[model samples]
Target: MLNLFKKKEKFILPVSGDCIPMEKVNDPVFSQKMMGDGFAIIPSDKTIYSPFSGEVSVLFPTKHAIGIKSDAGVEVLIHVGIDTVSLKGEGFESFVQQGDKIAQGDKLIDVDFDLIKQKGFDPVVVIIFTNNSIKIEEKLHHGEHHEKLSISIK
Candidate 1:
């Protein structure tokens, strides 16, 4: 079948932390995989990087989430924290603008997790497929950085 030749896209942990299954996320929208199947990270640092080469399709006005369309046409949404959007951009700084071309590891945003916590929010970074239906073929090792989380279309 033509599907046999489909190229797999590999993404890395966009933040430094333990990679966890989407089901482990504290949010229903993500834990239930309502937004789409992917992974989550309990980030230990403030910086978030691009998971793959792509064009930033949407950067929420609150600077809490960003969506990127990969070169292979995969749309990824990276949400910074749980309920942090209610902060209205406080404690969040975006490095790239919408429509900007980004490479893997490029800094996307800097967040003040302490502020998020002080504001009573969970600073869990959530990544999900926004436009296409794809399956995570492989997950990175726990605590691994700069390693790929391979994915393929169904």
Candidate 2:
């Protein structure tokens, strides 16, 4: 009966990388969860995937970031590095457009790591739920790609 009442949904990691606690990100905005509660990844691959099945809500003009609205009503923002917007999308390639339907694990973007570093940027992909009305369960101190984390609606 208790399980039947559980409102939590599993959100997967969009990249194939080592998940780190948000504080490790070095940016106050992300480490502070000011954008929303979520995790950061020290990505091993150049690609980015969708963490949930949802609609692509926003794709920044610079192509350095993207946002999605999950079918379950969660709003997610995936920002691809610290201050990387200054690069003006130089090393990034977005695979999806705004208003497109996406599924978890769908490839969303591809990044040029060397260019980012050559340009002196720390490429830390952050996954944040912009709306705080929901509760994010687990510290998510670390995890593997596509690992499940629960989010409960309040």
* Alpha-carbon RMSD of each model: 4.0, 3.7
Q: For model 1, how does the per-residue alpha-carbon lDDT over 1-154 read when each residue is reduced to its tens digit?
A: 0121154555667788777778878889998998887778888899998877889999999999999987878788999999887899999999999999999889999999999999899898988877766666665454555344556665
Top-scoring candidate (TM-score):
1
Alpha-carbon local distance difference test for all models: 0.81, 0.79
What digit string (tens of lDDT, one per residue) describes model 2 on residues 1-154?
0010143445667776777777778899889878877778888899998877889999999999999997777788999988999999899998899999998889999999888988889988988878744455556555555355555655
Off by over 4 Å in 1: 1-5, 138-148
What TM-score does candidate 2 get on C-alpha atoms?
0.84
lDDT of 2 at 146: 38
